[model samples]
Target: MAIWHWIEQTLRSYPELAIFLALAVGYWIGGKKFGSFSLGSVTGTLLAGVIIGQIGIDISPHIKSVFFIMFLFAVGFGVGPQFVRGVANDGLPQAVFAVIVSCLCLFSVYLAAVLSGYGPGLAAGLLAGTQTISASIGLATDAINRLDMSADQIQAQLDAIPVAYAVTYLFGTVGTGWIIAYLGPKILRINLQEECARYEKEMSEGEPDGGMQSAWYQYIVRSFKLTKPDFIAGKTVAQAEAGMTGGERLFLENLRRNGKIIEFDANTVLQVGDVVAVSGRHETLVDWSNRAEEVADQELLQIPIESIDVVVTSKNANGKTLLELSKSPCARGVYVTRIRRGSMGVDIPVQAQTKLHRGDIVSVSGSRKHVESVIEEFGFADRPTSVTDMVFVGSGIVIGGLIGAIVVPVGGIPITLSTSGGALIAGLVFGWLRSFKPKLGSVPSATLWFMNSVGLNVFIAVVGITAGPTFIQGVKEVGIELFFWGLFATSLPMLLAPLIGKYIFRFDPAINLGCCGGARTSTASVAMVAEAAKSNVPMLGYTVPYAISNTFLTLWGMVIVLLLG
Candidate 1:
């Protein structure tokens, strides 16, 4: 009894301890599985905060704003490049589909809220929970605070937001997954795996690695002695490579003549006793007996080699296909292992004809010198680093805040974007600019993830704790009707997703499901669909839509609140 009393007193005296406790316990709860459905950390953290808040702990509202702004900025930064691409390029179909879905989501929630006679705060909570766009909660909160109401009324509305969110988030997470993964496939009436295979086959412009099955080492390097005089002995490196007949191309990186390693190029002549280091698919390199004897030339094979991810930024490489790039002199000694495109940077099916976009990241491997040259020719090398450029981030937030603070009175009603909205817009611009000028605004993926996840979770934890005192009462007031309304709002737009993708966008069956999953901004739904289809092909259509939907859904939070208010 003494220990319990001491612990309670400590938590009360130092309320910050409660926040960390809620976070730890909340993450643990979120990680647990409840029969194929698990509450994510956001929902879990919010609930934990609410439970902990029952101790009547009072935390400053400013804490919530700080964390919320950080999260909004991170989100905008992460999706900025893709958002711009979706708007300006061939991703327009998927972008349009996502916009329609987002609009429908807003309308559905508004309709549900109005029908249920809910206030703006409750409506915002429903929108956030049903869409599973946790960022919307911040927007809604900002909108509610802007309303002309008494302090007590404002607190009442603020307290009601979390109650509605906690109740509806369960269905929002699991229901969206079911509709996209299972229901959408059922509506299409096509075997997912077969359709995916067909689509993949159609997309493959050339037989990858000579139609060879993927081996442990798809790209490998081997040293061979030029023993066959009739084969490659008298030919120049370029001439010798020209004589080879196969789907896969090999590049010679080093040559050892007179027992000394020398850098060789296309025009370099080959001698009978020279040992050459060749890089290509393992399958293609396995048949070296016909041209030369395999040799373990340590000095020749042990040259400096590297694999780096290069973000495509050069106009010379943009819109070009892999096959086209491969023919360039700059690509002679480098091998592209993967092409990562779209918003999320997930690897798409890379073939000879896969086209390159300005921001696509191409993973290439070769001799260090060769790789560096390719990196220069292609775009910026995203070298592994732990440092983040804080100057750019700080400046963007300040500028965005200034921009957002501008108010334009429409018919005597003062309207402003609020600082949060400005931060989001600023993040987008900064993130996009970073793609063009890689040296500036370098927010590494790790730092961005921290800012995105911890920032949002911490803000939510504060919101939960603050609302905890009124939570039970808020739930009781909102009643069971809120849950049903959430279901209605969550289901309506998701159901329309597939139909819109197919009939309007005319997307492939696999891509249709992918776009639907992305439109809902549900990673779990896309993962489940990929599992069901037995391919990552669905992810091909995911990135652009995900980027588009994520941006708009977050903004809808403010819009819904304004309409309801």
Candidate 2:
């Protein structure tokens, strides 16, 4: 009994430890898979925090706010490039679809609240639940505070929010995942794998492995022997490569003559009986090999070849792409093996169309000479570093907080972004700016992941603990009405999302589901959808809409609360 009391005392005295425990437990639980469905970290952490909070281990709101702001900024920073690309001309339609889906979610919340005789708090909770956006809970609460009400009435309204949110959000997360993963394909009447294959065939590119994000990093190496009817013979390497067209333009990496490998240059001309090695996309290299006299042995071509990660610091490669650089004469001797954008996400395949940003650590493979050529054309090779740029990160947060402090009037209500939102906005600008000038910010990928994942979990863990006191009582008061309202809210927007996306906008089935997930701001659902599709093709539609909807839906949560609550 003494030991138990001491442990409880320790937990209460240092709530940060308790909060971290919840995160660790929740993350572990979230990773456990049951067949096709898995409870994700976000949901798992919230529940874990709730249980811990119910025990009397709780942190201050200020700590929660700090973590929340950190999370928003990292998210904004990461999505900066995608957000910019999505709003452009070619990407405009997907953005519109996402917006429409968000509006639909807003309408569904209003319709659900009005029909159910729910108050402003419940109404706002319905919106947050249906969208599966946890940020909405805070935004909705903020909006309620701005309303003109008696102290007792305000307290009552504020008290109603968490119960309704707590009930609906759980289903909101799981149900959205199920709908996109299972129900989406049934509605469209298509096999997801087949559809993705078709899309790949149309593009003439290699297939995506699950949702690796991009195919640009997918590469292959093949060796060819020079012979008669070979344009490469007696011609300079650059000139020979330039003569090839389409996917046949392979990067010449090595040349073997007289049982020895010789140095190559732009002026180094190929000779008969000389075997040369080329590296590029599998499809490109395969086709290039077919046009050769004979495919040589792999051993000679493999000599002294190495892969190195290069940092894109040169202004020339900042706005360009791996595909463009791959096609350039300088890139003919090397293959861009993979890309790590801002140290986040798995290395995406090198696709031709994916834009290059400054500071992107790109993996290129070839001989020392060819690698140097690629480095000269793009930027410098990456240096090893585990340390994060603290100065840059702190500055971004401060700037974001300042930005969030600015207020704007909407129908004379005096609206303003919370510190988190403002920081997110600032992070977006900082990230985008970093793409142009590689030296500006240096938040390591590992650090960004920590800020994004752990930060969000910590914020929600605090919320769950804080809400734990009134949680059960609130649920009982609302009865099952909140659950049904959540069901209605969750189901309606999804049903309408794909229907409108497909028939009205003519989005591909894979893309339509992605748009639906994005509009609802359900990243978990998007992941499931991409998994079901067996391709990252859906991501082409998901990213822009996800960015647009995340910002809008979070705002709408407050907007609906202000108008109807």
Candidate 3:
């Protein structure tokens, strides 16, 4: 006991050490799963920090704010392009369902707040806890400070918020996690593993078969030096490639004869000594090389391979798919190596059916002349430089920060988006713009993940630590009744989620539960949904609604207080 006390004292003396230890231990705890249910890093960190703080650990509040905002920005940036596309596409129904869930959450919070006769502080805290929007604490606090109340009244009300939050927050997390993971599958009467397989098979036609089966797509371009194979001696370039079959198609890039490069033509007859560079996947190229005689020129083998960034600006390519666009006559002799849409790069293994939005910047690779000609058909081609324009990102964040500071009065209730919310909006806009110009804002996936996962956990850990000491006392004041009321707020919205998602939105059970979890901003619930369904199909339904739900649910903290108080 003495040694334990001494260790606690030592950690208290250095706040940074306390925070680091909390993050490490909390993350380890979060990874622990029991039958496909895990607490997740954010929730684990919060619980750990609360326990540590209860025993007298501490960290600076400013550090928590910094971490929280970074998480918001990363989440908004990662989901921005998808959120934008979802609003107008197949995801629209999910988006509308998410709005329905959020409104219901608000209504539930108010119903519980009214029935329990909660003061302004408890009402706001209840909103935050049930919705799992931690930022609401600060925003609600800000709103309270502006209220026309005496010092003592304000102090008493302010103190109640954290107490109410602590009491309800845990169930808000765990209860929803269970409902989505265990109960959803049972209610839907579906077998997760079988359904995922069936869905995958149905969706996989014409898509690139990956792994060992993708050998045909593992293409290489080689310069063949012509020593005459009598078989193809007098055949034209097209005729030479026409005899190939089975694995993949072959295309002649160009012919090099007498120090000049000629574009391949069906009519251009190949001479005995003509050198041709041919491009095709491994299977086709290898098959052709076995019969054709070889000659290698250093310069020709090292053909100037360049990438052109072509923006999709016209209606012809706007809603058409990448596979469809690739087959256009204009796409001859060029390969789409990558498609960059802002911070997001589509994982196009064989998902060639992915629609190209108007602003998409596709990276096409081939010889310089061919790339130019191919790019001209898609849109204007620009050589996207490695340099990321930081000015655009900086300005957007700054403007967003400024915009968040303005408190608007709606029906005589003052409200503001806050800096964090503003940054999220800024990230979304900037991310969307990057999809078009692609010359600006170079945030990558790794960085976004780091900011989101690390940032949210750190903020949560700090909150738990800071809220720990007062936690027991606060719970004592509110009594267990607040918890049951919180359970009502938490359970009702989630219970209604599956019904609304499946029947109204006509989504499968996997997607409905995912939508429900996402609408609540609960990653733990989504993870549970994926685990229960034994497939990532839920995640497809989760993304857009998650983005939209996170933003609105966060703002509703203030809305609940202002409207219902």
Most lDDT-accurate candidate: 1
Lowest lDDT block of 10, candidate 1:
209-218
**Candidate 1, overall lDDT?**
0.84
- Give the per-residue lDDT of model 1 (tens digit) for 261-356: 887888888999998888766667877755688988777777687888999878788777776777675676667778786546676766665678
- Model 2 global lDDT (CA atoms, 0 to 1): 0.72
Off by over 4 Å in 3: 1-37, 48-70, 150-170, 189-198, 205-249, 252-271, 275-277, 281-393, 453-462, 477-479, 508-510
lDDT of each: 0.84, 0.72, 0.70
- Candidate 2 Cα errors over 4 Å, as ranges: 55-58, 119-121, 141-161, 189-193, 205-304, 308-326, 336-364, 368-384
Error (Å) of candidate 1 at residue 455 is: 0.5
Model with the higher TM-score, candidate 2 or 3: 2
lDDT of 2 by residue, 25-101 (tens): 88988888987666677667877877776767657768877887888788788767556655764557877888888
Query: In each prediction, how many residue pairs overlap at the backbone (N, C-alpha, C within less than 3 A)?
Result: 0, 8, 2
**Which of 2 and 3 is the better model by lDDT?**
2
Give me the overall lDDT of model 3: 0.70
Quantify how close model 1 is to the true structure by its C-alpha RMSD in Å. Answer: 3.3
Give the TM-score (vs. native) of candidate 3.
0.73
Q: What is the TM-score of each candidate against the true structure?
A: 0.90, 0.78, 0.73
